[model samples]
Target: MKDTDTAEETSPEPKGVNLFGVDPLIIQDHYEIDYRHSYAQDSPFFVGLSKGDLLGSRCTGCQYMYATPRSHCMECGATTTWEKLPLIGRVHTFTVCYYGGESFLKETPFILVLVEFQNVNTLFLSRLKSIAPEEVHIGLPIRPRFTKAPTFRVTDVWFEPMGST
Candidate 1:
């Protein structure tokens, strides 16, 4: 009958709450997603993790090595081949992360390191565990440890101090 009554009849139910504050307003809501993805050309890399093997790419043309998977060489533009990387490497560099993305948020205050392998031209980026952030140092010897139950994700493998059990 009235404008307010008509508006209420057509309005949809609210699913979330909005909070107004100092600078910007915040909306709180629950969100979820079921994401499906394919590794495709990078399938071997993930598979190697499940088998406790670290796989990389080697340029067939220039012989350049990459610590990460690649189907083609960035240097020579040539097709690359899969190479098994050494399980042991040294900390080329490192940083302590106090914040991270949604997946890693729970694992905040973690350490990320660039690992240097013998004869490898590029460094591999991975999580360094079992050590304090202040204890991480350059050239620190580390070794890869694979999860017993693999998820075929990069997180299936992480590095820890060589002597740590």
Candidate 2:
């Protein structure tokens, strides 16, 4: 949820990549830039993204680990420290977007999801990769895939069905 009149508000064109001689659509630049410069800066999310690790913020005081870093803990209101979490989790929620704001992403129907780690309830919002929409389930296991973006230092977070390899 964002206010319409923010300083960063700008319309962006979609991006595409040559995937094995085929052009694959990407998210719109406006949305991508908004996400990169906004909530991601202060958090260790980018750090993990760069290192190909799924990082989270943990309340050192309460040992509550969150998939994405936050300034403070939701449970205890204490400062959080970054922790690298395992990429394994179960899908908690998901949605298939038929219409992507960006023309690039609009080419293919994509799945957005919230996944929860095993033994821990911490959830991370991400996209499903290389999986069919019909195969996705509320409790399907998944693992992270760090897309190697050579042009950008920060790797992108994508997910695959567990045992996908």
How far is each candidate from the true structure, as Cα RMSD in Å? 7.8, 14.0
- What would the per-residue lDDT of candidate 1 be over residues 1-165, giving only the tens digit for each residue? 675587667665444533242344569999989999999999999999999999999999999999999999999999999999988999999999999989899999999999999989999999999998988899999999999999998899999999899
How would you encode candidate 2's per-residue C-alpha lDDT over 1-165 as one tens digit per residue?
Answer: 367676545533335635466676656664334344455545457656766877777786787778766778899898888777886888999998787765437446989888898645477887887888999999998998886663233227778898897
Candidate of highest lDDT: 1
Model 2: residue 154 alpha-carbon error in angstroms: 8.7
Q: What is the lDDT for 106 in model 1?
A: 92
Point to the candidate with the largest TM-score.
1
Badly placed stretches (over 4 Å) of model 2 are 1-43, 103-107, 150-155
Question: How does model 1 score by TM-score?
Answer: 0.82
lDDT agreement of model 2 with the native: 0.74
